[model samples]
Target chain A: MIQLNISDIQHFSVGDGPGIRTTVFLKGCNLRCPWCHNPETVSRDTVTLTYPKANKSVTYGRSMTVDEIVTEVMEDADFYRQSGGGVTLSGGEPLLQAEAVAKLSQALQGHGISVLLDTAGCVPWCRFEAVLPSVDTVFFDWKTSDPTIMRERIGGDLPLIKSNLARLLRTDKGIHVRIPLIPGVNTSEEALTAIAADLRETGAKTVALLPFHRLAVGKYEAMGIPYPYRDTPPLPADTLRRAAEILSPSFTVYAEK
Target chain B: MGCIENFITGMQPPWSDGRFDTPRFLEYVFNDGKGYFHPSAGLNTGTAESITSMEILMERLETQLRAGVKEYVESFNRINVLPDPENYTAPFLSLFCKDCIGRGLDINMGGAVYPSVHGAALMGVGTMCDSLAAVEQVVFTHKDATIAELVTALKENFVGYEDLRSKLLAAPKYGNNNDFADKYAVWFVDFLSEEFMKYKTPDGGGYYTAMAANVSNIYAGHVIGATPDGRRASEPLSDAASPTYGRDTRGATATVLSITKPDYTKVACGTVINQKYSPSMFEDGRRDKLRALIRVYFQKGGQEMQINATSTEVLKDAMDHPEKYPDLVVRVSGFSAIYVTLAREVQMDILARTQQE
Candidate 1:
């Protein structure tokens, strides 16, 4: 009986993950990454008239019933057959709505469609395990390796994200690691190399490089939240190329626009 | 360079002799809306019925021409010709007519070009400044084509001479961002606007302008028949094929291009403006750019344009995630197509090009 809040669904999408995909943008997330382009994904409630005046950056989806979510999942059934594409659950964090994701994914798999879940690695293992059984692939965003650094940006226990990631890998669930290249925040060569080495250990072969962009800065104004990292410029292209080259030895690098 | 200028001026190359000699027909076309055959007479796509009030503008142009308005046409090229070695045509005009002209604005001057399969096709225009070297390459340097022979080739569709056709097509056309392309683009636009103002539509609509000339006429073959220009009947339409050419020229050296605005105007009687977005205007981003572009277009003498901005995101989701947003519409290349029915590549391409502007 759990519900889902989804902002938008995209089919024939190539940028979100490997292969063509129908990316389902879930409505909420538990994190508050200052640089998140989709700041709308940072909450759970679809519409809240009033609450304690908190950061407007936090927004989630309207709750939709499982049948409704499944109806959305089956929209791209034809796309999956031709492009080898599948559905990818993305959001503030699909894990926050793991029950809805599992329900929808299981429904899709029943009809022979492949499913993928893209998350910020902030949900519980029970949720992850629950959805993993039905989903075909998972892209776990590993923003920062440093616990305190991660905690400063994303709410929730860092230990929980690390453990959930490890669990997915230990179980050999379809999982890929993703890193956003921020200029000063995570550009240390050591940071790249360290994450690469850990991902190499996890049997996860690839890491997608999502370069930080200034496009979402305006969205922050609409949400009425002071951008936490105004001085952090986007990573210069060459620096990221170098980081990719540096990490190339340990983990397969996938660059996206 | 020496003779192709005639074709450039829209004279059929001599190669085509007795094609449709619509002198009276063409004269009527140039008369604008006042002419008996004016498309707007009964069509009435919200355009003015007459331009009698603009006699002053015509007199000024005539005086300027007679006084030798030596102003430089701020263009990368003037009268670009996409090489149709095969003498075949492309479907660009027909497509524009059938697809882009949904509401029937009566301004889309479809090319004389027909469709071709052998050669590559081109589209897109170069940005323009003012330059002479650019003008020479665009207007002058070309194979010496007799109006008769060119018309014959155009009319005959390059039937017997595959070699000549191949050699002709081998001539490089322009596109992408570059100096030559840009220069030719400016000159070509100015020339057309200048020339078009000389004659009104049969109904006497005002002169048309605002042509986003393709750096080269890759799609020229779409209308490739011999034109009244003495060329064959079915020749390709150049990107410079818009009705107005030089109307945007501010001085002898600089050009001012404008986007059309939504408000009704008397000048848009016979012009075409290039539209780039769709949801807000039928494009997802918004209509500010469209409004701006159209405003500029109207300011610079544009008579026609197209739009599709139905927010591809809405459409993309309906297709990829139908449950996300169940009902959304998108403007396809020419017509409105359901968002969910579009190919993913098409959807992504639309998204990639979507703008906040």
Candidate 2:
């Protein structure tokens, strides 16, 4: 009867994972990524986002038991079976509530549904161990490679994240090391190569370069906070391709739009 | 004003056998209240009866075209080409219609202000399109079965040919935005409109096509045999102009895209596209998406769309416990009715509509 702070459950989410997945965004993140798209989930307290133009308000962060979460996500089991898609436990770093996630994943797996975990890999290794048994795939996000930027700018512990990624790479689960290609943060050749080296050291074989987009401007506006990257243009397609090129020599890279 | 009002008041026809004494000739000629000349009867191209009726209509059109438009119009005035009687609730003028009654003329006999245009309500656009696409792909392209085998299966209502029926069912169906199947729908509207346009009504009114079957699709489906699209005999033929129920697996966007492929300008009597969505989609923020979708559908030349926001779970529950949901309203085709009051088959038909997420 463990309860998890849930933000929102999005069904038929094609971009979250393979097939038609339902993404469960857990509330509260340990790290503060300024350009985070889902800024509403970064806080542990229940937050309401009001949109003036849309004349609507959406409140996130509800306490739902593992059984309730399972029942809700199970509604799309037929779609999952047809599309090879299942449930994706996303963040606010799902590893922050590893125990509830473990229970929910186990319940979904018991129903013959696959479970995927999308994490920033900034939490303790013990948190990863709690959910590792039920998760079929791990989408580990590797942001900037510099320790100073990771610690000061992004508010993440670089060594801890690297250790977690290295350990996750050793597991039998499907691992996808994803890099958010932010323009000033990680688009430079030096930054890309450094990330490539870090991932290579972790024994990662394949990487997906996700281009930075400004789709979160509205989310920030709804939260009544000015996004730091609001004025910044999206990463050009050529920039993503170049990042892919820099990482290609070390590993098989996928340039995602 | 008083004289006109008095004339209107005096125009009520005498009651005979608990019915207005309207023209029995027109009713007898058009086979009123019977399935003999139902507008949908000739539209199900899968049946031999439909083919024979279509041939007769085509031959008549050929003779009229050979005689030329001027002569055809003159001849139409002399001999009334019977419009589908279902278009009028009363075969003659209404009991209180002053002009037609004063002129001693039925409404269809050049009595009204405008000439009567014929609306050949093509019963099942989705069924016809799906059947054609399935026949093309399964029989001709894939060579999985011969025409003889398919006809035999259809004749037997797919009793022993479950495998072949499965192949037909698996073919690209209409309303998926897949042009392989959608092109046939486009052709259905265009070809029928062109043919109907070739002939004029009795009073020189143009012939128009309609996809608005209303509830008559249920009745029309009762007579239709097994279709090439793997529809069982006597099953409801894809409500109105919408895709076959449960066959539009793709979401609402693709459904709208496929439905809008047909040039609706030709469908002067209009078409009805029924779509169902969960109740959450009708909320304020999410409702904008539905509005955007509908706007795009209209921009792409879609005629009409009827959306039902009741979720399948609630609908099923209402069916099980009708007394609890006495006021639950649902859109059945182009109209709305209380959920518990609708016949079980109609409720089942509404439930069968794919709920686009």
TM, chain A, every candidate = 0.85, 0.98
Fraction of real interface contacts that model 2 preserves: 0.03
- lDDT of the candidates, in the order given: 0.47, 0.74
Which structure among the candidates has the greatest DockQ?
A: 2
Shift of residue B294 alpha carbon in model 2, Å: 0.7
DockQ of 1: 0.02
Clashes of each: 139, 0
Worst 10 residues of 1 chain A by lDDT: A47-56
Residue ranges of candidate 1 with Cα displaced over 4 Å: A47-60, B1-357
Tell me how each candidate scores on DockQ against the true complex.
0.02, 0.04
What's the TM-score of each model vs. the native? 0.44, 0.49
Question: Model 1 residue B21 lDDT?
Answer: 13
Estimate, for each residue in A121-215, the C-alpha lDDT of model 2 and write its tens digit: 88889999999999999999999999999989899998898888999888899999999988788889999889988988999999988899999
